[model samples]
Target: MLASPGAEGRADLKLIEEHVQRMRWHVTRSSFADVGQAPAIEQRTGFTEAFLYAAQGFAHGIVAIGRAAITTDNKAYADVLERLHQRGVFLSYLPGTGGPEPT
Candidate 1:
């Protein structure tokens, strides 16, 4: 038996929502930068602005990835998606990727 198109679409949407929720949880659980993990500028008084900038870039990357995921043969967006994904992978290996929120 074959699933209806509507049912398949709903399943896809549900999966996407689950992925979004997981990403949100990870973002919320992470600190902007853990103590001694940030550069001098960020450590002293630059955290808010720095985090805002990083968040902006991350949001843009998400949009790029979503676009690429739905587009066919879109090289530019696909490259952006890979770069953003690679950055996240690299960060996962960093020493302070997760910890209590910075003070």
Candidate 2:
């Protein structure tokens, strides 16, 4: 399914909430740079932002645990997605790629 605004960042989370299932994988609509390039906002000590990337996929769902925060720590979003994907939990998009491989 396609991702909505602020939906991509927490796509898996939202899907879990609605469907009570797990998101096996999804190709990222936007790259890590893309998400980082999204407008940054002020945090208590830093700046950050959150955006969602889209991907084509089969059956899945999500559940957001918290809010999206803008941050200068560009690696945070990518890191979370990467760790999850590497562990065979979630997947992110890549340019000109079909999608991420299941871990």
Candidate 3:
């Protein structure tokens, strides 16, 4: 995820939405690329980059949730953390995995 401005500021949901949209487009387009087309190179690279960005975002989000958990007693944050945990993002980076790993 991009470094947010200020420690305690509102999140830009629009930015997050755009990121999701971009990633979706990259994957969709890349999946349709043929073996040896000029556009295939671009599409494949975009897909790889988008996936890497998403993985990074998940890792950063987990860290933020932990910090929020200790610094405050917000039930909303707890709920969010639970949802994230349920999605298996917490353990998404175990042993061997395909594609780019989270940093």
Best by TM-score: 1
Residue range 1-103, candidate 1, lDDT tens digits: 0001255534644454454455553332122222332333323222333234444554222211122122234474355336545544211111132311211
- In candidate 1, stretches whose alpha carbon ends up further than 4 angstroms from where it belongs are 1-5, 25-69, 75-103
TM-score of 2: 0.26
Model 3 local distance difference test score: 0.30
Q: Pick by lDDT: which candidate is best? A: 2
Model 3 residue runs over 4 Å out of place are 6-61, 69-73, 91-103
* Candidate 2: tens digits of C-alpha lDDT, residues 28-98: 23322223344533322111112222222222211223224222355765665654454344332322233
In model 3, state the lDDT of residue 64: 18
Better of 2 and 3 by lDDT: 2
**What do the candidate models score in CA lDDT, each in turn?**
0.31, 0.33, 0.30
- Rank order (by lDDT, best first): 2, 1, 3
Instruction: In angstroms, give how far residue 38 of model 1 lies from its true place.
Output: 45
Residue 93 error, candidate 2, Å: 15
Question: Residue-pair clashes per candidate, as listed?
Answer: 0, 21, 0
